[model samples]
Target: MNRADETGLAARQGAASILTAVLKERRAFDDAFIAEAASGHLRNAEPRDRAFARAITATALRRLGTIDHILSLLIDKELPKRAGATENILRAGLAEILFLRVAAHAAVGMNVEAASRDENARHFKALVNAVLRRATREGDAILDNLDTERLDTPDWLWQSWSAAYGEETARAIVRMHYADPPLDISVKRAEERMTIAEALGATVLPSGTLRLEDAGRIEDLPGFDDGAWWVQDAAAALPAKLLGDVTGREVLDLCAAPGGKTAELAAAGAHVTALDRSRPRLDRLEQNLSRLGLEAKTVVADATAYAPGRTWDLILLDAPCSSTGTARRHPDVPHLKSPADRDKLAALQARLLAHAATLLAPGGTLVYCTCSLEPEEGVRQVEAFLAAHPAFRRQPVGVEDVAGLGEIVTGEGDLRTLPCHLAALGGLDGFYAARLTRAS
Candidate 1:
């Protein structure tokens, strides 16, 4: 179906249709679905209406588990199957009343009216109305008593972080996801940083990253077409910076694709060799570098297997992982991932770290990083690699090295940027990074 049709189906047809389309089609949250379904049709949705629809959809998805919990307590019979339109209408209405704090009268009136738009949804009207009213009246009790800490997060994720960082820290991390993340951009030329910041009315972060309140359509930004800047998070930029004084050195960006780190390396005057297993991803890297007028020796091969003719002074392994740390930017990741996925990715990271170590010249640096919050994929992976390769030692980052990053460093000196830490500035993605040196 066309985008317009899909949205119409979502809004008029009920919340279940939108959620169904997302799960079955494996698509991102269809704000359009919520809008069309919420509005009873898809034509001419203004920006404000679209925003409200998006908020409604996001609230429901984020609190899907809790909403279900509330339903189980109130429903006399099992809620209709998820694929049914009845269940979806209930979910959307519950999300608004319970979580969104949307005014009860307005929320109920709109939901009931929206449900009547489709005959299939008619059966759900009584259920939706009763549950929403009960939730609204007793909402304070539910909000006060239901574990806000566990409301939206998976059990494994909540338990893991709580065990590692304490309940307060875990709750703080969870709280950060309730809001939208700011637009963080990394400039290609240091000189353009100020100009871009001024145009967007943003502040220059201590780490030299740009933090815009909300710069829509990055490509439309003043310097974007000119290739003067690219979008990289403040935390993601640290791996390249940790290599320290890379001028006139040869570096390898292993598994570099959508190559932000590669661009940073090239900008730092390193003759970079970029390698990846996927040719299409490599092609994107080449295109990015070309846009910035930077050059790199591009190779399409598995980083674990490809053998370049010579060793290099530095190598960066932005290893794949569970991506738990990036929940704010990519909320869908937590839903798609399983604990098994985390374990599997950890095993792969161990292999990539060992393999990347071999390509670093004696006395050179190997910076390992991942957008994963799990210790198995971060600290544990590094510890395992160090045990196997005694010649390499953890050269922990110093507090003075990276502005605004010293606080997130673990006792062992690895970088760990959590969403909670960045709440003041709209937060940053979770990341783990460590620098290792090979014995000469």
Candidate 2:
């Protein structure tokens, strides 16, 4: 076989392995990819092969519901419990043919060979070849007619979003998840936004964030090692911006692992303290800070119990939640999360928010935010906090504060960004933020 053919085969094998990890093992996609790469499963593959494997795996997970529906039509009986690997092989194969536009012949052939190599799944090799061939012929028609919005999203999540945002918005959110999300970056210096955007061939959003079409590895980009910018989602950067003019002010960033907001505060000249419960994630945060040449006092402690022994002029509690908003980037979220997970996270968020309030000095601004679409974690959480802590009151976020994202602002002046909002700008993560002021 030619070199290109060998690479394609290796990539399909890697894709099936990743699919198995995500679906059967319930591992996160990033973790699965790292494990596979570490094991040398993809070591010899070209960069294009690696990219293809990643794309196929992500597409299969994102559209898993619909892919399963199509498989059910082809297979008469329910798949056996031991057929998990076989099922994932079919999913990876079909994802390529149906979505990635991979050539049907090559897609089917490689997957069949991959199945044959696995002892437990070898019995289904013929089935894999037959189903994928049929899928290449008729899968498009079935996919075109299916209720994709319902098919693409988990039933529990879809129901919750519909109840919270109404049917129309929920459907929009599901539809957006089908497309690959764009890359957004935050420049270290606001004054150089235009120059940086031009250099990177990126578009500068009204909110002063830069958007780039997902090209390749971020480390390969210019100025990456120069500490000129860092990667932060457009919606995520808003919480720090709400703490207007942090020049020389003391700011505490709770649950700040992976430190995007802490970096924002430091870049704005705030005396920043970054706190989180996970040491591994904090290590990553420190690495990013070092790369950007910014500094923050990093503390490894639970935000709920962390007391710095001093009141802060501002506090950003970007509390941990279900993280459903990041589904666009992390497709494993829907499969890994459930309604019960949301409840547990919401309870944790409340405790963190309350403790953060204790560290806020009189008249200090506190921005409570979550990358969650759930009201119980965002709007209701803030409402409950305000009712319980009469000493704190909502400060009302204005359109001017979020750079004309007024449509996302609620009647109570909280910012609620949905995955469907800014469709023309390639959408943003579903985020909820409420700014409050402590009574002097």
Candidate 3:
């Protein structure tokens, strides 16, 4: 095969391998992609081809439910038991035909060619060709009256969202996933944010997050190396701001790795102590800080167990959870996580929140936040914390605090943003943050 054909085939195979890792091995998508690279499955591929592989993998995962539904209609019977990547190959090909704008012939011919080369699926190459070719001609008719929103979302998520936000709102959230979310960034130079946005051809989100639509390869963006801005979802950027006027305050950031929140706190003139358990993640955070020209005291210690010598004036805890709110950006979330996963993470969050409350300085502010849609991780978690610890009371956030996105601030005044909240601007991640303080 020529180099171009070989590159395209390698991309397709790499995508299928990643899909297999996620679906069959039950690995996280990012981890699987990393494994593919580290293991040399994609390390030798050209940059453009590697990107294509990632795109195909992400698209297949995101539209998995819909793709599976279509496959059930076209394939009358399953293939041989030993068919290794054949099913995923069909999935990747079909996703390209239906969602991506690849030419029908390329999708079909390339996928068929891939099947021909795989020892396990070579016998069923005809099946792959027939199914994908038929899908090209009849896929639209089958999708015409289908409830794609429901099909695309897993039952556990749909039911949980229905119970938490009600059925109508759950459907709306599902619909929001269909639109490609825009990249929202936080500019360190507040006075120059507008100028940066203008230079990058970005729209200033209501929350002051510069929204960049179709900005390819974030590292390639101008000023990225200069650390002028960082890619943070508009909703994800709200929590650090809740510790009002953090200038010169002693700030502790728990779970601060990959430190978007830590960067925010530092940029706002806080004397920051960033703590997390993972050394590698902390190294990355430190690297990010270096690039941004920000400074923070870093510690590799568990948030739940660490008891520092003294308390801080302000603390920001962006605890880890099921991460369902990031489904739009990481489509594997709905497939990889479950209610049990939420419960497990909720327990950890409780431990972290409880420990954090103890470490707050008297009359100090504590801001607890999570990028999770589940109530147990957000509303309920804070409610339970406040109930158990009467000393700390909620310091209700306001619309003005977040640049007038009132619809996101809850009735009780916590910042509760949904992926469907800012529909006109392609929506933001679902996030819940509560600002609290202990009385003097």
Candidate 4:
């Protein structure tokens, strides 16, 4: 086969693998990508081909609900239970033609060819071509008339977000997830923000984050190797900043794997001990710290069980959640997470919060946060924690704490950032954080 044909086949195969991992194995896209890359499925492809595969997978997953909705209109009967792979091929094709704006003829042809290569799917090649061709002709009109917010969001998630943030805000958040998020970077020194922004033609946020329209190949960017900055979302950067001046203080970062916040605390001159349960994820955090020329004592232990031998002056627990807030970047998150998972995570967060309170010194601050839009994981978690621990009191974040993100602060003084909060300047992940202090 020629180079172009080989590249197309590789991309389609990669997309199919990603879809199967997500739909059948229930794997997160990031984990699936890592698995694919480690298996040489992606490693063998050219850099451009690898990128295309990734884009196709993300696009297909992100718009899967809408694509499926359109596909159902074209199909005469329900797809067979065993036709998952064939269905994914059709989804990929529709994604390319409808969302990615690829030429319909090429998109349909490539996907049909992809289907023909599989014995199980070969029999469905005609079906794939027919459905996709009909999609190309009528999909846009169907999509235009569909209630995308309802179709794209899972019923449980839609109900939860809508009940919490209201219908209008929930719709806005769902719409924002359809587009790729911009890259936000946190610099080692605030003084260097302007210089780096100028170099990359990026915008500097009020919170000192450098925002790039598109940060392709982050390692290739200037100052990346020099340890001048690190990639962090504007919303993700807030929890550490809420601590306010951790210099010389003993800081504990719980569940701090992939430690952007750990680097933030260490860079702020705090003596930080970053702890996580996953050794592999901690390894990545250590690599990030090394690249940034920063230091933090790393521990591979569960946050609830670790004993630091001393009470921390400041503690940041970036607890795990459904991570629906990051759907914009991950795309597969909305498909992979379920309401039951959120409930289980909320229970864990409550335990972690209670445990973290015990580790904080009298008069020291503890920040509880989650990359979740769910109240059970964020607002209610903190409220319940306060009720259970009489010694701890809400610190109430002020306008000065988040800089430009003052609008997202709740009346009760917690930070609740939504994907729609900074809509005009791209958007932010839905994050909730509450700063609490123990009475001395």
Candidate 5:
């Protein structure tokens, strides 16, 4: 094989490995797969190859339910037990043939080549070729009859969103996830948003987030190393803004690792103390801060256990949850999380919320947010918190607070942004945030 073909082959092989990791080994597609690219599956590949590998892997995971369904239709009978990478190889190839729009010949040829060479799957090389080729020819007809959104999304998530947001809206959310999420940048200097966006050919959203379409290789963009802006979802950026004008006020950022919110707090001139349990993630936050020329005191401790020995003027507890809201960007969410996991996270969030409440000064504001579409983690979580802690009451988010995105403002006046909320502006993450105030 020539150099280009070799890279292509590696990318396909790498995609299969990623699928195997997510599907069989049950590792997070981002944390275990892409984050470890240099030392993991794509280690030997070039940057372009790694990107291609990621695209293929993400496509497969996003459409695995339908891909598996189509594969079942194509196969006459099940293959031998312990089929090695056969399923992944088939999945990666079919994703290319169907969703990714890769040329049929290349997608089929490379994956067939992979199967023919692997000792475990060599016996099924012909089967792989037959299945993918037929998919290229007959896939459309089959897909025309398939409810892809229903097929692609997990049952528990579907039912949960349906119960929370209504069945029609839940379907809309799943349909939106079919498209890749747009990149959103949060600028340090709020007034400079338009100038910075124009320089980068990006548009300013109603929420003041800079939305960029087709932004390739984020670091390669202007103002990256200089840290003029950091990548944050438009919806994810809202909660920080809810804690407005932090100028010189003391603020506690609970569960603030990989700190976009910390950066916002620091940039807005809060005497910020960012806390999280994961030292490595906090190290990343520190590096990002160093790049942005932002400053914040860092604490490595669990939000549920940490004791600051003093109260703060404001607190932002972006508690940990299923992160289902980010499904458009992180396709592994539906495959990885479950109701049990949501329950587990909800329990943790409750504890963290309770602990954070104790650390807030009387008459202080605490903004609790989660990138979860699940109600148990959002409205319900805060509702229970307020009921138990009579000292704190719902301050209620305002239409103006979310930069005039009134469609996302809930009836109770919290922020409940769906992934499909701003579809005309390339959709945002499904985020929920409630502002609560403690009485003096």
Candidate 6:
């Protein structure tokens, strides 16, 4: 095959690999898979090719529901129950032509040729061609005009969000998921912000984060080896900052893994104990601490069951939930997760909070947080916890306490962030963090 044909083939093959990984292998959608696939076609594939593959996969994932809806419109009776491979090719191609604005002729021809190579895909070429061509002209209106309710999210999820945050905010959340996420970084030290931003070709966020327009290999960046900073969304870095005046105080970082907040705790001169369940994940936390030259006591124990011997002055509960708020970064979550998943996760979060409450010293602070947009997992979860345990009271995060975080913190003392919050600055991650105190 010639150069043009080679690139086309690489794109198709990469998409197929990613589809298999998400659907079959159940791997996280990331750059590693694309890079691995590129090893075969182009010797030392350029970042451009890697980007093309990632875009195709991300586009297909974000718009899967809409693309499937459009496909149903084209078929006379129904598209055959063909192999997953064939369906993935059609989905990838249709997504590019319909949603991503790739040329109609190019998308259709390349996909058809790519499909013909596989025995199961050969028969679907005609159907695929028809769908892509039809989508090329009217696809935008078809997608744009569809009921946002039926776009990608489950009805129950939409209803839950509407009930909690109103219909407008909920719909805005859905819309933001389809928007691309910018790469965000948190500096280890304050003064390094300008140097790091200039070095990585990033701009300094109002929140003091380094926001990169285009995220490339981190190892090649200025601060990667020196450990001047680590990659973290601006919103994700807020909870630790809100835990005010931790210097010379004992803090418990519950559910700390990959230890970003734990680093913050140590950096603030807090005597920190980082607890997590996974040994491998804890190993990573140790590695990160070593890189930052920060020391913290590490424990590998379950959050719901583990108990520290004594009470802590501060506790950071980065509770696990459905992680729906991170959909822009982890697009597979919405599809892989169900309403049942949220309910189960909420139950577990409540359990963890119940346990963490016992470990807090009188008048100490506990910051309950989750990288989840779902109210059931955040506000509702905290509300339920407060109701169950009267000793714990809301210690409101005052505007003066947290710099650059006034908008996200609610009057009720909850930190609520959505993907739409900083759209112009390449939007922050959706998350919720609440600071509470145990009465003396």
The best candidate by TM-score is: 2
- Model 6: per-residue lDDT, tens digit, 1-440? 68767677667757766765786666777644644564643235556766676788788888777777777776666646664467778788877887678888888888877777767777877766776777787778787788744567766767877887788887777777886788888777778779778888898877787898667677777777887887788888888877898889889999999898998888778999999999999999999888878899999999888855788878999998888889888888777778888999999999999999999899988999999888889988999999999998898877775565577878697888887787777777888989999999
lDDT of candidate 6 at residue 244, scale 0 to 100:
90
Residue pairs in steric clash, candidate 1?
10-37, 11-36, 11-37, 11-38, 12-37, 16-88
What are the models' TM-scores? 0.88, 0.98, 0.96, 0.97, 0.97, 0.92
lDDT of all predictions, in order shown?
0.78, 0.89, 0.90, 0.88, 0.90, 0.80
> In candidate 5, what are the lDDT values of residues 1-440, reduced to their tens digit?
89888778888878888888888788988865664476754678888888888888888988989999998999988877657889889999999999998999999999998887677887888989999999999999999999988889899998888888888999889878888888999999988887899889998888788999989999899989878999999899999988888898989999998999999889888989999999999999999999999999999998998886998869999999999999989998899899999999999999999999989999999999999999999999998998999999998888888888899999988999998898988998999999999998
Residue-level lDDT of model 2, residues 278-347, one tens digit each, is 9999999999999999999999998998866888878999998889999999999999998899999999
* Comparison by lDDT, 1 against 3, better one: 3
Q: What clash count does candidate 3 reach? A: 0
Error of 1 at 28 (Å): 5.4
* Candidate 6 segments exceeding 4 Å error: 23-27, 31-47, 148-150
Q: What digit string (tens of lDDT, one per residue) describes model 3 on residues 1-440?
A: 89889888888888888998999899988889888876745877887888888888888887888999999999987756799889999999988899886899989988888888888878888999999999999998898968888898999898889998898899889888765689989999899898899889999987788999989889999889989999899988999999989888889999998999998889989999999999999999999999999999999999999977888879999999999998888878899898899999999999999999989988999999999999999999999999999999999998878988888889888998888898888898999999999989
Cα RMSD, each candidate:
4.0, 1.2, 1.5, 1.5, 1.4, 2.5
Better of 2 and 3 by TM-score: 2
What residue runs in model 3 are displaced by over 4 Å at the alpha carbon?
37-41
- Top-down lDDT ranking: 5, 3, 2, 4, 6, 1
Clashing pairs in 3: none
Positional deviation of residue 268's Cα in model 4 after best superposition, in angstroms: 1.0
In candidate 5, where is summed lDDT lowest over 10 consecutive residues?
Answer: 32-41
